[model samples]
Target: MNQTVVSYLAQYEFFDSLLALFGGNQGLLTFVIFMIFCLAIVGMCATIGGLGTYAERKISADIQARIGPNRVGPYGILQFLADGVKMMTKEDVMPFSADKFLFYLAPMLALVGVFATLAVLPFSTGFTLSDMNVGIFYLIAISSLVGVSVFLGGYASNSKWSMLGGMRGASQIISYEIPVTISILAITLLAGGMGFGTISAHQRGLPTNWFIFHNPFSFIAFFVYFVGALAETNRAPFDLPEAESELVSGYHTEYTGMRFGFFALAEYIEVFVVCGVGAALFLGGSNLPVDLSFDIIPLQLVEVVIFMTKALLLYYVVIWIRWTFPRLRVDQLMSICWKYLTPIAIFNLVGCAIWVVLFNGKSVAQLLMGGGH
Candidate 1:
């Protein structure tokens, strides 16, 4: 009951703040504040993608004990900026046979679709842009635009390789989305709520209180979701769309200058978003093991840091996987999805249901206490 009230008041205050900003003479202030907030997030993304590009090479190179990107800047740190400027100054190319309107719009659409999903994501308790009752549903609905945007980019390219990449993206996202859904469903069942705040709050005690610990099935579901998420976002071992040797930049083959930059940035940011969502759903989110209520550091800062830590760590994992593993054949990729992930997800869902009926929180807790011999 106490938890219920806190959630209501937090959501009410958030809505009131937004409504008040637009309803009064503070409209201009609201607009500027909103723009700044969005710009901050964008700026952070740019920095991550830019610097992260260099970091990926450096880390991967160090593991192999070879020199990496040393000439571009100190430890090759400035390489990303150089790459940005180079991309910016490059001549824009549009194929004469391409659909010019869509060719130009595709990258922007992809970026928009990818970035827009961040709006509903809660960084920490009482700290999202807006905590809609249907936040999860909103995320799902908005994220599906990635598929449409990929299709548009591919179809507009007027190149067979580009079209093939787009189609592969379409199929890959669709296939992986199933296991992702199943994994997320596991969380919803355990938390008994859909809003991210509620889920985060439900695990307030220790890291062990995370939904990932609610049942054995949920723990497995988390890994299943993480794997599918890699596939869904077209990252690393799953990045067939941009197979450098085969497709020479794939769906955005004709994109140049800043247009290509946007596509590249979107892909990286999407990587961050998916991993962040995973952390929030299964890893106890912003609730640190310590008492958050008493933390001297701002809660928002801690939340963002914890959230980003999870995302970036996952990002590194993706890079490692990319460097270590060869791409699977298209047929093998589909078989892994249908034969392995999908069936396992279905079994996990059923297992969770049975676990809940036979031995939920109380029973499990008792067993841990050595009560039910």
Candidate 2:
């Protein structure tokens, strides 16, 4: 059975009192708890999405030798709030010729797709909304909704530039998903399961225990995954879909006010999700550097902190890369996915399979320590 927040909490004595307070209806109590957690996670991610915009500008300004957004609040901390207010108050304009239904549906889909994946994200073992057995696969499948939203947004706009941008986004996202999925498949093989809990469990203890260092092939696969994920999320160098210089804001060219905000928020939140997944898969997740024997609420909070720290560091790297590198041409983007990342990812997957067989799934650290299987 999949563990959930409710189940995790049920183990605690305080939960019994809450259960009694709810008139002993487990189902109702579970539903209420799920709703609370759902709202909490969504609200937290929404805030992160808002801050992502702030971080992007501030970091870019630093790179370009300019001060950014310092007037809104302390160090411009409230800039995102200001931007949110501006977007909310701005007039939402749609093209006269736009397909109104799809134009309206597109932004909702983007936000829905991003928020859906939060259910399985391993924020901490106990805090995850749902620790689905097929967590990673579910995430990959559900998040593809963003691709659909992009295409629909572009097509519905009835603009030539939006159409071109949509095509680029759909094709780029679909193509890059191949290597990214395959690279994750390699890690799944190493960890012997598809669930985030299982994968993270196998990687507990120290940095050396992490799957990325399990073998050379896995190390290479990590980079392949990162590159492919960057493209999949339409980050710089792979942001052909939204190449403002060429396509004038790409698939979302016609969006305005809160509609535009939805697209932008989805993109930023997706980046965070991608970074969090990468951290969970390759960076030992929320595990402390040393293992602890007890499970406690405080320990779980620490795990959350550890997990967020790793994820945010990767987030910083993503922003840095966006500022440092020039965007790739459409042809170059396709070639990188098809000609290079795909082949390398396949090799890594095959190599991981063979390594598991020959070494009985022992990581490099295990072998180095003379711990024979």
Candidate 3:
């Protein structure tokens, strides 16, 4: 185990330090640190996701010129928490027609998979819980769970509407996966030569140095990734699976009380995950985009702000698009994947190959300018 992991585990309790010695207690300190890290992350992500929910309602309300949840608590800030408490108190109900086993299991799977994806996100340069060698791969794998969990929830519900939702969700998400992975590959091609750590290091100063601005290829990749991510997360317009008039709440149609709340919460969490991943890949993750003598704001604070602002901006866009656009017909949705995103991502990858081989690790503009002299 890495020394950092060891150190983090040791933070849990001095007594547990002995557990590391038996090859079982590698480092009590590191394990303890990670435990705290996990708790803090889960709590903060939930709260932030909750805040996003509140903001979405408020924003949606304003777009329609209506009051949204204002009476609950000071600008409706308390509404999410109130909803949580109410949900926790509500009875977990299963339709008599549903599969008793899977119905109960589905929501738990969704909640766990969505929340766990946050563990690897780097809020600051060194603030991440686990900087696994496979950070990017881990993100892709864990995030994909959202698609599966939706299938489980919808399939388990035993309603024709729920089954339709599950089937649609699975199809849409699975179709979108190609573009998402391909766009990710574009980023991987541009920067995966550097590990997540090295990539973050590369982005240490000046925003333009960020991969998103590194070249034209990267610029296009971001848009491709964003669109594919929308499909993956089932956001509006791309959200044919849960089309209200069509599917009546989609997969969770038969769920009630806390079970349904868990599903609802998972949707927002997926949005946050997409935003954070985008921030990390194209928006400098936690790096400041400017040249700095001393990083006027410490890297930790800068990382948190840069990453969060990017995430929140992306989150807001998801909301904006949901309200601004109409839902696509199933054929339109599939057409988007096959015709638009896929071709663009593929062409962009070829552009990246040309750019990389010719530039020889130099910035596009610098190479064009012959600025080296």
Give the runs in model 2 whose Cα sits over 4 Å from its true position: 371-373
* Candidate 2 local Cα displacement, residue 201, angstroms: 0.4
Q: Estimate the lDDT of model 3.
A: 0.79
Model 1, range 27-133, lDDT digits (tens) per residue? 56445555665777677766887777787788789777898899886777898898899989999988889999989888888888877877766666644655666
By summed lDDT, which 10 consecutive residues of candidate 3 come out lowest?
1-10
lDDT of 2 by residue, 1-373 (tens): 6989999999999999999999999999999999999999899999999999999999999999999999998999999999999999999999999999999999999999999999999999899899888999999999999999999999999999999999999999999999999999999999888899999999999899998898999999999999999999999978989998999999999999999999999999999999999999999998888888889999999999999999999999999999999999888888999999999999999999999999989989999897675
**Model 1 local distance difference test score:** 0.77
Best by TM-score: 2
Candidate 3 residues lying further than 4 Å off, grouped into runs, are 1-26, 290-298, 368-373
lDDT, model 3, position 359: 76
If the candidates were sorted by their lDDT against the true structure, best first, what order would they fall in? 2, 3, 1
Measured by TM-score, how close is model 1 to the native structure?
0.88
lDDT, candidate 2, residue 98? Answer: 99
